[model samples]
Target chain A: MNLSKKSKVFIYILLTAAAIYFLAPFAYMFFSTFKSEAEAIAYPPKFFPSQWHPENFIKAWTSQPFGTYLWNSILVTVLTTAGQVISCSLVAYGFARYEFKGKNILFMILLSTMMIPWDVTMIPQYMEFNLFGWINTLKPLIVPAWFGSAYYIFLMRQFLMGVPKDFEEAARIDGANAFQIYWKIFMPILKPSLILVGVLNMITVWNDYLGPLIFLQDRSKYTLALGLASFKGVHSTQIVPMLCITVVMIIPPIIIFIIAQKYIVEGTSGSIK
Target chain B: MNRKKFFRTATPYFFILPWVIGFLVFTIGPLIFSLIMSFFDWPLTADPKFIGLGNYIEMFTEDDQFRKSLVISLKYAAIFVPLNMIIALFLAMLITQPVRGVKVYRTIFYIPAVISGVAVSIIWGWILNSDYGILNYLLSLLGIEGPRWLVDPAWALMAVILASAFGVGTMMLIFYTDIKNISIDIYEAASLDGASVSKQFFSITLPMITPTILFNLITSIISSFQQVTLVMLLTGGGPLNSTYFYGLYTYNNAFKHHKMGYASANAWVMFIIILLLTALVFRSSSAWVFYETEAKNSGAKKKRKGGKEA
Candidate 1:
């Protein structure tokens, strides 16, 4: 494509302006973390702090049991990511490779389930969890992912459908059973899709506020998101600490997104395409 | 033959058993149970009592908050869907242009989407503060006083909408991908015919990407109706209940107030509405959404690809 020099400059300026628009809020929050509480809320809202305070991160961490919150978040994120990958892979493999009665109907049903609003099932699931003595623990958040969500199942199925059948047939000729072929051949080949699923799940589980808010009432069991939200409600006036903790809370997902961004962007396009 | 067929089918079921069991126990069972529970006066601590249509009748007739919440959410969807679609399409087009550091800008835009829910709400809470906020301060520079964003009832919904719109990154990326897939030859042909860039965009690009537009529209609509976490964290449906979204109402009813039956009834109504809306979108899409491969009804492209492989 050819562009006039004037048009090229225009495109660059427009893009730079958009970049700032999208990034300004996060950048402001980052700078506010270094400001004193009063300065953070001072009139004419300072974009840069007069005096930098790096200790706010430490102060915020000690203000609550953020250590426990971090642990809970890591536990739920790791377990759910693993569970979703394994379960969704198994299910996707079943659908991708096999020709069986009711296959089309089952796949259609799985797709339809993605449209069911989470609110519709929240009441009964809460009741069911309460009955099983699962509320207030990480069980409610962790256990469900082991069953495979509809969206992840759909994504994995789309990926696996494009994999050629020759490898599975060759493995079968070598006396490999269905599970063996899945374990050895397909699992290795599905690494990119698995990473896609893992990164997506990690971001979601790491940043989930509502699931932890409803199920885990105890602060000791609170995920980072829930803990930070509780902090916001209680310490509404403490801007520095709140902003500092907000920065800490968002670091993991941002880092993960940056590292695995190619898989996320390209894989999403591939799925929809 | 019967035994052989049983084994053939049973193997796949064995692999899929976890999901099957999960679907039954988790999704289907709860869906039915919630439906049944909606017809009762079920409390958390007390035994459930049968009251057929009672909760529904009360929600429709007596519950003013219920009606308000529904309208508020619908209003939110009304603003959010169109705004999101336009912004997403614009950004997608912007990034797809062959400019310097485009990938970096794409990542920057998507960063907000990855850091969602509580963190986003808290960030926006500070920005939308009436007196001390950067936004209001910026407004003052132009000699225009800004309204109290999250605090004022009149602007709270708009504040929430602005906050949520930051996540248009995902939609933008999807559109970007679809737009990138358009064959360059068509644009070249349009250029030969002396078509302007804007003209080519509307006449060629927009028509081709209509299928993706439809996909994003339905998904955004469904998710917009199901929005809760942001509202709960940002405003908590406060300032005269201006931002009392339907999802938050259902949550508060079941969890805060412990009116399980009534909440279930609220949820059921929401579910039906979503289904109807989705069906409506799908019904309307046939008129606009064009499938290039199917609508063309030619295998010329398919044959070319086949020739390459052979």
Candidate 2:
């Protein structure tokens, strides 16, 4: 459709205004991280720091056991991503390709599982984890993903269902077993969906706070999100270091998002359609 | 049965065994256990005393916080769900325009959503700080005295709403994808028929995307109710328990107060409310939500000369 010049100008102005609202906070936080604490919170807040203090990142990183928190976060994120990709793919393939008696019911059960809010199940999960002596360890966060989640399984199933019915017939006729076909043939074909699952899982697990907040007691076991939140309690008056840490904490997910924007967009649109 | 036949019969279940095991151990078991715990007066560190319907009765008749938190969550959802959807739909429309540099605008709008809730709360906390915050400082430049955003009970919910709105880009992207999937030929046809842009939107674009709108509506309702992290970190339920959201109330009850039995009752109440709301919305949706297949079948006969296939 064609638009008049005046309306196009109006559109540009509106777009620019929305962009500023979205980007201003990050810009402010990034610039403020380089300032001294006093200037960071001055009455007339400055957009840019008078002097650059690049060492503030170092100070924030060492203010707590952030290094350990970073490591724990990496452990959970990597393991969960790997677990979710593999497990979700297998489950989705079964639902998509197989014909069985209970398949419809089981698949419906999987879909309905997405509606169960975490509040209803978390208390018992806490107790169960405690019973297993898995509390405070990474097991509560990591082990569950190996079993596959409903949303990811649903997404992978959507992708897999789009493949032709006879896509696996040649491999079956060539004497390949089911597991072998899944591993060698389907896995390669499911690469983009796998990356999509891995990326989504990685971002969620990396940023998860409530899990670590509840299960982990010792500071040594804290994830980055938990550590970042601990700053609100311990360093409530210290704004610069908190802002510095917040900036540092957001870097990984932002980088991952930028790199995998294509798959994320495609995967989301695929599921909804 | 022979070994090979048995294996063939069990093959699909084997492929899906991980989820089956997960569903039983992680989901179903916990659900049933939680339900049972609601009936018992379970303490954090001691043996639970079985008291049938006691916790539920106490919640309905006794606890003021239960009612207050429920109202707060409902109030938040009532204001939040519609406001956020409007902004998301508006932004989605904006970014879908055939203008230069809209891609950069799209990325900018979505960047806030990629940041974690923890970081978002912290950033907003500092920015909304009354004395030293930039927002008020900027307001002072305009000779307007900004309200104490996080400290005042009246404004705290609004502050929470403001911070939460930063993440509207996810919903916007969902809407954008659905809108983009719409064929441009329909819009062109409408344009040739002398329909204005706004008319085309209401008649064509809006009706075409009701399915996505319904999807966003349900998901956002669920999320608005489950809002815990932001309220926990940002306001900590505020100066006057003004923003003591039901989710945070439940979290604090179970974790902070260690009233495991009572929190279970609280969780069950919220579960029922959400289920009811979702069912209601679904029941109402048949009247509003239009699918492509339905449009294809009856749209030409009913009305709208152009864009009949949407």
RMSD in Å for candidate 1, one decimal? 3.4
Q: What is the C-alpha lDDT profile of model 1 across B176-251, one tens digit per residue?
A: 9999999999999999999999999999999999999999999999999999999998899988899999999999
B1-310: candidate 2 lDDT, tens digit per residue: 6999999988989999999999999999999999999999999989999999999999989999999999999999999999999999999999999988887788888888888999999999999999888899888899999999999999999999999999998899899888989999999998999999899899999999999999999999999999999999999998699999999999998998888988888898999999999999999999999999977768666666555656
The estimated TM-scores of all candidates read 0.97, 0.97
Expressed as tens digits, the lDDT of each residue in A1-273 for candidate 1 is 787899989988888898998899988899889999889999988888899999989999999999999999999999999999999999999988888879899989988998889988878999999999998999999998998988888888889888876768888889888899999999998999999999999999999888888899888999899999999989987888988888998898999999999899878887775
DockQ of each: 0.81, 0.81
User: What is the two-chain DockQ of model 2?
Assistant: 0.81
Q: Can you tell me the CAPRI class of model 1?
A: high
Sequence-dependent TM-score of model 2: 0.97
